[model samples]
Target: MFTPRTPRIVAARRLQRRRDRDQTGRFLAEGPQAVREALAADAVLELFATPAAIERYPDLAAQAPELSPVTDDALAALAETVQPQGLVAICEQNDVSIGEALAKEPRLVAVVAEIRDPGNAGTVLRTADAAGAGAVIFAGDAVDPYNGKCVRSSAGSLFHVDVVRSPLSVVDLLQDNGLQVLATSGTGEDDVDSLLDGGHLAPRTAWLFGSEAHGLPADLLSSADRRVRVPIYGGAESLNLAAAAAVCLYASARAQR
Candidate 1:
């Protein structure tokens, strides 16, 4: 069993940092679900599991191209969670270029711009996949999609959807691809339901979502084809980023399908 101080274990632990992940072109995916998804995507480079985890998930171990039996202490050293799930896979960073993603002629897409919270970003990614979005673009200063919290929060959807990390102008890219760009804002001129009712959501669409603290920038909002708001019938002031994204993406999904 590999110990915490083992050379390979030490190297794997470094992946917890963004700099290391970027430099190595790899990231860590923890828990059985994430490991299974990474394996299915052919993104896993190496897998580390505790003896008990291997026994409990023999099928996962059997499928690994490379597996390392790690001591519980070593797993703890490598994991970011309070209770490590006993399995972690070192996987390749699979983000594609914005042009490449748009080349597929996706009907529905989500553009995450400067969203710093990993949980919110991950939830949006998972929601996009559930709503049948063809791609998700992490633009501007958005959080790393490979963040452990983001990966865990995505619940395996990260592997299922096309991911794009680009600093290019997303509005222009989507517009160039014949996708109508819609930005969500409290003071927006159009309502989501109104667009759906008018059959405007049937076309290829890309929903632009901004940071949790601040909504989309003025330039992006202006660049969007339409600024839309999700009508809230309740006393709630506003919906969080992930909730708002779900409402908007599903509206488009319903209209397009």
Candidate 2:
């Protein structure tokens, strides 16, 4: 077994389960993009990169002053993925509320409800960042935004976006702030395109999507101002939630532009 040079850091990584991370108010971001974004955003407390990964991304070393170049075994020891590479960073998680995020200078928001897939949630956040959304809201039963897998899947976009976690009250708060809380569902009168065509996409709208398997909770579904679906021509039952959210948010982006 390969031993860690920095025992304290290694011990912390070994102890960094989801609950431990939540309690400590810290999380790890894995991969080159994640580490770079964290450094660029000044969100990282510490950075750890391996020799090979550092060789591939020398700019990262130039960017973050407090980086540690360690062996691949050490980097792999801290990672949650099967193939951890490039870099990793420990950063403080944002404790801001969805209510606060809704109250900020954002016209577009992507609402993720009960989205169990880390890839879906991360992709939605990435899309929101690309769309210049004010915030990405993780409503009830959603996956943890700070999960290492989520951070990696986001492809560095997490650093540019405001991620919020909260209950359903923020939905009403969004409405009060001139936002239209539109949910995506199979049974809907108007499609997403119709809403966008009618110019409803610019009013600080919230594009709500659901989990892959269960969809949004029924109560939350009923609470939406509008239930809309994406029109499909292929034999697919539904577009992946991340793809759907991307389409919705980007459509809003194009409409606003």
Candidate 3:
């Protein structure tokens, strides 16, 4: 059994930080679901799990004979949570550039700008995947898609969709790809449902969701082909990033279908 101080465990632990992840071009996928997804994607470079977890997933363990059995303490140390699921996999980063993802001629896309919350970021990716979006792009100062929390929150959907991280103007990139860029704002002029009813939701569209704290930047909002809002009938202030994104993406997906 591997100890907490094992060289591989040490390296895996270092990946908990963004700087180390970037330097090594690797990230940790915790839990059976994430590990299975990473393995299916052929992205898992190494795996660390407790014997119990290994026995629980004997078929998966058989698929990946490189699984390393570790003590529960060692497994907990590799995981980000207080009580880990006794499984973690070291995976190579799956980052794709804006230009590269755009090359696929995606009909629907989700663009995130400066969203700092890793959970929100992962939720958007999961929503986008469920909506059958062609891709999800993290633009400007957005959080890293490979963040441990982000990966965990995605629930393995990260591997199901194409993801791009770019500092370039997302609006320009989508527009250049012959897609209509729709920005979501709380005080926007157009309502999301209205756009859907009006058939203004383009078949080839990219929905832009901004940081929940600041919303979309003025320049970015203005750059969008159009700005739309989710009609809030309730007294609540507004929808958060994930809620707003799910509504917008589903609307577009229904329209495009």
Task: List, residue by residue over 1-257, the lDDT tens digit for candidate 1.
Answer: 99999999999999999999999999999989999999999999999999999999999999999999999999999999876579989999998888889899999999999999999999999999999998999999899999999999899999998999988377887898999999999889999999999999999999999986899989999999999999989999899998999999999989988
Question: What do the candidate models score in CA lDDT, each in turn?
Answer: 0.93, 0.78, 0.88
Give all TM-scores, in the order shown.
Answer: 0.98, 0.91, 0.97
What's the candidate order when arranged by decreasing lDDT?
Answer: 1, 3, 2
Tens-digit per-residue lDDT, 15-40, candidate 2: 35778787888888877767778888
Off by over 4 Å in 3: none
Residue pairs in clash, model 1: none
lDDT of 3 by residue, 14-42 (tens): 99999999999999998888988998998
Compared with the true structure, model 3 gives a TM-score of 0.97
Better of 2 and 3 by TM-score: 3
**Which candidate has the highest lDDT of all?**
1
Candidate 2's clash total is 0
Candidate 2: regions farther than 4 A off: 52-56
